[model samples]
Target: MGERGRFLLPKRKKRRHRTAVKMVLAGILLCALLLGAEHRMRPMIETVAAYQARLLATRNINDAVLDIVQEENVQYNNIVNVRQGIEGQVTSLTTDMVTMNRLKAQVTNRVSEYLEKQTMQEVKIPVGTLIGGSVFSGRGPLVEFRLFPAGYVETDLYNDFQPAGINQTLHRIMMTVKVRVVGVIPFYSVTADVNTSICLAQTVIVGKAPSSYTDIEGGVSPFISQYDYGLQAREKLPQEE
Candidate 1:
């Protein structure tokens, strides 16, 4: 109500104004601090997001590379298997060819041998001055009178002979025969023996000297004789025929 009260009131009002101003300044400082914090946090969030994207890209690339590598390995394995199969087939074909060649050679050799043997079995006897006879009274007697120049005889001795005076003669013969080589058959060496009887009582004996009589009585005798020809005669007989 007086001058002192009025002065205090004015001073108090001025103090209140100063306090309000300070509060306003503090509010502005708090707002700037919050804005600065928000700006800094935004950059950190972007950096984290970029790092996550890079990680995802790196993972995807690695997975794709792994898939490609696995595929390549599978292809390589398949190629190797195919190569092995081809090599095996080639080896088997080569072996079969060798076996077939061997069989062909064997068959050829057998055929050649058979043909050679067959060729040797066919031969004709040479008819020449061949003396064949039986023994009569310890001397040689003409049993088979065959003129070598006129008759054609089978050298293999496979034919039967009709004697001039005898009815029949049985012979089991093993002869050592010399045959001239022709083609596939070389010279054949044959051995044969025969049992023959002569009818000397009905036939006349020839080709023996009169003075070279076997018996003192000068008569024919029944006997078995073995005759052998020389190699020269055997060779010449085939050539002449």
Candidate 2:
């Protein structure tokens, strides 16, 4: 009986040892599953945080780009307005210049016409004439008064006169003259004075005489004949007679 008891005790001891080993292995497997789950959850959490940070940075960049575009548009509008104003001012100045040029041309034309009309009415005349004469009467020739287009006198005629004729009794004469422009509507008039002096005389006679008076030389008396009878007789009588 003692030997049977000893073999049963040894078998019991072996069964207790096997049960203890199985309990320890089950505890180790459970700890390994929990650790793996924790490790995987930590990586997922880090990835999500990184994505959120990228989104925030992208939003800020987009906002800054939008602000720059808005500022550029405003500056462009200002430039366009300024250019339009300058163009308008230039147009106004050009219009004024054209008007001034047209007015100047009209004034120049009128002045030219006036000067041409004045130049046409100049005249010249001989130095002797008779007009309602008393002896030593006021009469003379017409002289041209000349002026250039600039209204300055161009001739020296106002300072001198030329003699026109020679005869003692007919020397002094009065003149009345008119100067007319050809193809012009109105005429101009000018007047002057003249004087005469006789240098020689052949005879002097006074009083009247009878028509029948005769001289000893067989010629008619001087008083009884006409003053120009000597010249008339020479003309009428033939040379041989």
Candidate 3:
């Protein structure tokens, strides 16, 4: 009976030791599962962040284009108003044309100055031009405006109209602004041109007009004579006009 009891005791202790080892192993596995979750979750978070960044970059570039267009419109409005006011105040019939000519010079100078000011501004790309990873995943190949003045001038003449009065003269003021655009992309770049023109027509009844008023947006009947000095970077109106 004593020998039998000794044998049973050894077997029981051995079983307890094995059970403890298994419990320790189970605890280790649970801890491992919690810590390893970071490996899977971190990558997903990074990918989402990258995608959001790409979307923001796209929006910024679009906004940049809009900002440039708005700036050009404001400058043009200013030129037209200032020129009209200056000429409208003139009392001499001869001075009307002379004032308009002077106004052209001022417009040219204004455009030149605007281009010069823009040169000081650097076009910004909100996202770093290049993203890492495969080609499809990366953001690169961007376009930013580097507008430089090609030239600007006032042109067009209309002398076919009858004089309405002794002092009042009708005329059209045409302003053209030409700018160059550079497409900055990774590993390659290209340049393009954009041309925009603004037309201001004035007809004073009981006054004299050099001719009729014509515009890029077509004339108000009775064709007007137009001439200009500047790069016609945009689609030229059909010569028939």
Q: Which candidate number has the best TM-score?
A: 3
lDDT of 1 by residue, 110-218 (tens): 3233324332122222122112123222234322211111111122211111223322222121111211222211211222222222111121211212222222233
Choose 1 or 2, whichever is better by TM-score: 1
Which segments of candidate 1 are over 4 A away from where they belong? 53-241
Predicted structure 2: lDDT: 0.31
Ranking by lDDT: 3, 2, 1
lDDT of 1: 0.29
Task: Give the candidate order by descending TM-score.
Answer: 3, 1, 2
Candidate 2 lDDT over residue span 11-130, tens digit each: 998999888888888888888876775464333333333333233323322333234335333222222111113323211001122322332343334333443544332323222212
Residue 94 C-alpha lDDT in model 2: 11
Worst 10 residues of 1 by lDDT: 145-154
Off by over 4 Å in 2: 47-241
TM-scores of the models, in the given order?
0.23, 0.20, 0.28
Where does candidate 3 have its weakest 10-residue lDDT segment? 228-237
